[model samples]
Target: MKKLISLLLNRLTLVLLLILAQFIVLVWLINFFSNSWQNIQIALMVLSLLMVLYILTRNDNPEFKLAWVIPILAFPIFGGFFYLFFRAQNLNMKTRNHLYNVVKERQYILSQNIDYGLKGNYKKIETFLESDFWPSYKHTNSIFLPSGESKLKVLLEDLKKAEKFIFMEYFIITKSKMWDEILEVLIEKQKQGVEIRIMYDDFGSATKLPLGYYKKLRALGFKVISFNTLKVHLNFAMNYRDHRKIVVIDNKIGYTGGINIGDEYTNSTKTFGHWHDAAIKIEGDAVWTLTILFLENWRFSTKEKISYEDYYLDYKVEKPNGLYVPFGDLPLDKNHMAKDIYLSLISEANESIYISTPYLILDNEMVTALKLAAKSGIDVNIVIPGIPDKKMVYMVSESYVPELLLAGVKVYKYKPGFIHSKIIVVDRKVAMIGTSNLDYRSLYLHFENNIFLYDASSIIDMVDYFIETIADSVLITPQEMKKRNIFYRVIQTILRAFSPLL
Candidate 1:
């Protein structure tokens, strides 16, 4: 009874209830007006038809369009009203202007100091990223971590070396052994007068961290903010989340990948069998790019105008020679940069393509690219989780297996447990590792970050790790997929149809 009461009083639950009540009221009013007024009924029907037309004309993913169109066609009144309420994708104007000013003011100054000597296809990739405002760097050293436990050890050691400020942004931050150990170090660093700031997604950490956790951090003199804080009302803005995991120490070292702040990442707790993940540690001029990514988010969340000079490291550090292009994707931007990068990598692969992701929901464009690559006799392999964290999403992911298999794309399921790593390696010469998952949300709806390496030693390391993981994974056969029941296939089709919303 106490647990039930606690759940009912939870902030997320309360907010959801409030939103549900509002939706119910809206539906009730629509029905009442339709019965009482012929004009109102005709007007609502016309609005729904217009909404369907508008959705079809908008340049959006077909799956996303279909998800809305089917519902609107079924329930004209309420569906049109809901779509009208939630359709706008713009950030608040003030926040958008501030972000643009921050980037515009620093773009040239930051780009002038680094030179990425690119050749052949690497040059082409660099040029594309530059055109999209993601600059390539030359002086950064990249270290590909194969597991979360390995990253945590290196992260702690790097944290101990911080002299000035520490910035961390993650999708989820839970109060667990992993966070407790990191927090202890952060608290000690605070005593030494080192500045610290953290940003975490409210929706991601809703069930893990207690309410007012950010307030407690602020009281402790740590600058902390929740990304898109949840409210007791309907909010379409809440759908776009900050899903990037970034840590920058003193503007010299940075880390980003699939790992979040939880014991599961470390494989200390067996929530999903053995938890497998990956991260990349970067040092040198490229770290500054990550610092900017964090600051842009901080400025937006806090509404603070920041001088770039305050956190920018003026001195250059000697690092290994390679091209490291760290980039970000914003829902406000029309360019789907991350997905485009993945598609290009697949299309450009000459020898082999290896990928690891938690989810495998691909749109037609990506599927076509991969299929073409495989049909051309390039080795194409993908690894996903054997144990899933979300069962419905897992079912949806499985729905794509048969078509990909028929197209000659090889798919593997890690036999040990869930693999949360987001990595792609092509031809053993180019690789990308970071927070963007291979799904509609990461590609279309979330703010994400990734690093692409050209001719970097990390590419070889990533390839080696992929081979090792494949040894432990079980390759899926067409026969195995065909064994699924007809009822299950029907469910999968229904789930896949609406996967964009999932």
Candidate 2:
């Protein structure tokens, strides 16, 4: 009973309940209006028909479109107007105009500076450049930090060393030991007169952080923006979030990965047995790209004018060999660059593709790609958490397992605890590590960033780390997947069907 009360008192639970109640009220109003007047009913039906027609002709993803179309057609009275009120994709683009504009303009300049020197025709690199306008650079050095604990230590060290300026952007930030430690460094740096700017997603940190947390940080003389500050609104615009985690120090060093600013990330106070995650510390010219990514987002959040050249520094290692491409994906556009990038990596892998993600709610294209890769004799291996942080999400991830296991794609459940690492190593020749997960949220809805390493030394570390992780994980056969009860399987299927919306 105490456990039940605690769950009910949870901030996340309260917020979800409020949102559900609001949606119910909205549906009731729509029904009431339509039933009260024949003309209103006729108008709503026509509106529903028009919306269905428009959705069919949209150039969006097929699955995403279908998810909306079904409800609108089924309940013509409420669905059409509710979708009208809650259609967040268009709302997101409309509301975040400055953010989108800044991203595009900065990306244009960054693309022009690409120095892909003799990195002959790897279409995947070209895919990022031509499509996303994110450039590839040589003379960049990378160090792969295999766990969040290692990453936190190095991050603090780097933060303390910031001489000129520091920039940090994260999806979530809670008042925990991890944030306290980082805040201590920032406060010291603030006293030293170093420029510090921090941004955290308002929706992502809504439950994790106390209200007006940004105001508190600002009071300490550090510039901060609560990205897309959540307000009471029926619009679906709040669904889009800035999920990118970045830390740029003096344009010389940059860090990004699955880790967020919370104790669970570093296992200081474990929510699930142990929180295992990966992050990358990239030093040199590639750091410039990360710097641009942060600055552009910061500029949008504050409407603060920045002389882009003032932030540029000649920070690059001397005569480095391999290629490094730091890129990002914004969900406002029709292009699903992150998903395409993942598919490209999977398709190009000759020997093996090793993946580790906390979530595995995949769309059809991704599912087909993984299955096809396994059938084509590619060693496709995946690792998910053994102990889940969210049981429903874990179940949705499990729903994809049996089909993959049947197709010869090896699946492993990490035995230690929940693994939050978002990593993919392809044949030891290329690798991608960053904020992207194998789920729809990372690939479709959220703003995310990642680095592509081609023949870079860091790929070896990523590959080696995967080798170590899988060794500690439990491999499951088709028979093992079948052990799930029928009732449990039904719930997993139902959750998965609405995954796109989730």
User: Considering every candidate listed, which one attains the maximal lDDT?
Assistant: 1
**Model 1 score (lDDT):** 0.87
Q: After superposition, how far is residue 116 of candidate 1 from its true place, in Å?
A: 7.5
Residue 419 of model 1, lDDT score: 94
Candidate 2 Cα misplacement greater than 4 A, ranges: 1-39, 90-96, 116-124, 127-131, 318-321
Candidate 1 matches the true fold with a TM-score of 0.95
* TM-score for each candidate, following the candidate numbering: 0.95, 0.92
Candidate 2 lDDT for residue 325:
82
Give the per-residue lDDT digits (tens) of candidate 2, residues 206-235: 778766778899999999998877654566
The lDDT values for all models are 0.87, 0.84
